[model samples]
Target: MLIHGLLAGSLALSGTPATTAQAKIDCAEVKCLALTFDDGPGKSTAKLLRILKKERAKATFFLTGKYVDQRPALAKRTLAEGHAIGNHTYSHFSLTPRLDDEIFDDIKAGQQAIKKATGLTATMFRPPFGHTDERVLRIADELDLAEVKWTGTTHDWALKDKKKIKAKVLSLAKRDGIILMHDTVPQTVQAMPEVIRELKKRGYHLVTVPQLYSGKLRSGVSYP
Candidate 1:
């Protein structure tokens, strides 16, 4: 999951509004959050998927179309394994200095690739470097995609300490919440075992992004 060029990615989209709390959600009475791993269905992704399966937790994977181009089987496996795929754009460049034309094309390519790889179309997108503008949001909305803004983030891509990352994760995670972590970082992957264990100990039930949106819990966006 070497992002190659986008290493400077995870600053949480410049100028984003203060995060909305997913903590207060009713959770459809299921009481778990939607865990998301972005920037990949990369080399590390299969291992991550195995870990999640062991925990009986499903998550959303926002993968870049270019990466999927090379890892077609992994992309298909992501869906087959019961996780969700979200658009993370094709040839994922920084979304800053966002141009409407490129943004639209990026999203479309991602959609096409996901459909081709997984036989499903996604209605969610995570902007590269979290640096999206109105043009990006507008296209996503126009295309009926929901712009998901996560409330809890692990900052794991920064190689933060595993214990500290887990603490941040536990402190912020909530029912029907969207928890952001990355498969691109080794440290993040290391911290996941503990994070899953803790959440389950606390009685949380992990579910995929689609399930998060479709269940009795009141999600921010409408379901298919």
Candidate 2:
């Protein structure tokens, strides 16, 4: 995949070794759950990354271009730590309402921002607020991004309470599920330690979105 190739290139540019001792888990044979956080590389994201690292869990982060420009180091560390990154649009705009050229420009700007920040081109995208349509998907496809939607969302952006966020995540947990969250939310970051531990206890392998699909994602396709 283009993203995989970009990952390798980024690693080389950063002087990080591409090979890792981490053993690969085949999701097809195990209960795998993808924990995806969007709209970030925010202040709270560093804490979230620490929690994930302590739990030895890998996740996928959909980064907004504006935030990437603000926290380039955080974005680089995210990919370097073995988590996957995806474009979440340049300005976090709702692509569904925009004109076709505007949609293309926004998504393209996002791709450019990510590339500049981390030297990696993202092949996955999640529309802000989950607002998308066929046209949005087509525009993303032109940028070589697959549309990644969630099986369930914690709605942590609204809840804004750590306990409630944790509870919502537990309730929505499932095998091969892509769970939506926001790393920009402080309460959600606070809730992650407990959430990661509990999900592990439930025997689900916390993995990146691409790992959930075994890295066979196609551009323009919406995922499970």
Please name the candidate that would achieve the greatest lDDT relative to the true structure.
2
Tell me the deviation in Å of residue 166 in model 1: 2.0
> Cα RMSD (Å) between model 2 and the true structure?
4.7
lDDT of 1 at 52: 69
lDDT of 2 at 83: 83
- Tens-place lDDT per residue, model 2, 85-121, is 9999999988899999999998888898899988888
Give the range where candidate 1 is weakest over 10 consecutive residues by summed lDDT. Answer: 1-10
- Using TM-score as the measure, the top candidate is 2
Return the TM-score for each candidate structure.
Answer: 0.79, 0.91
Error at 189, model 2, angstroms: 0.9
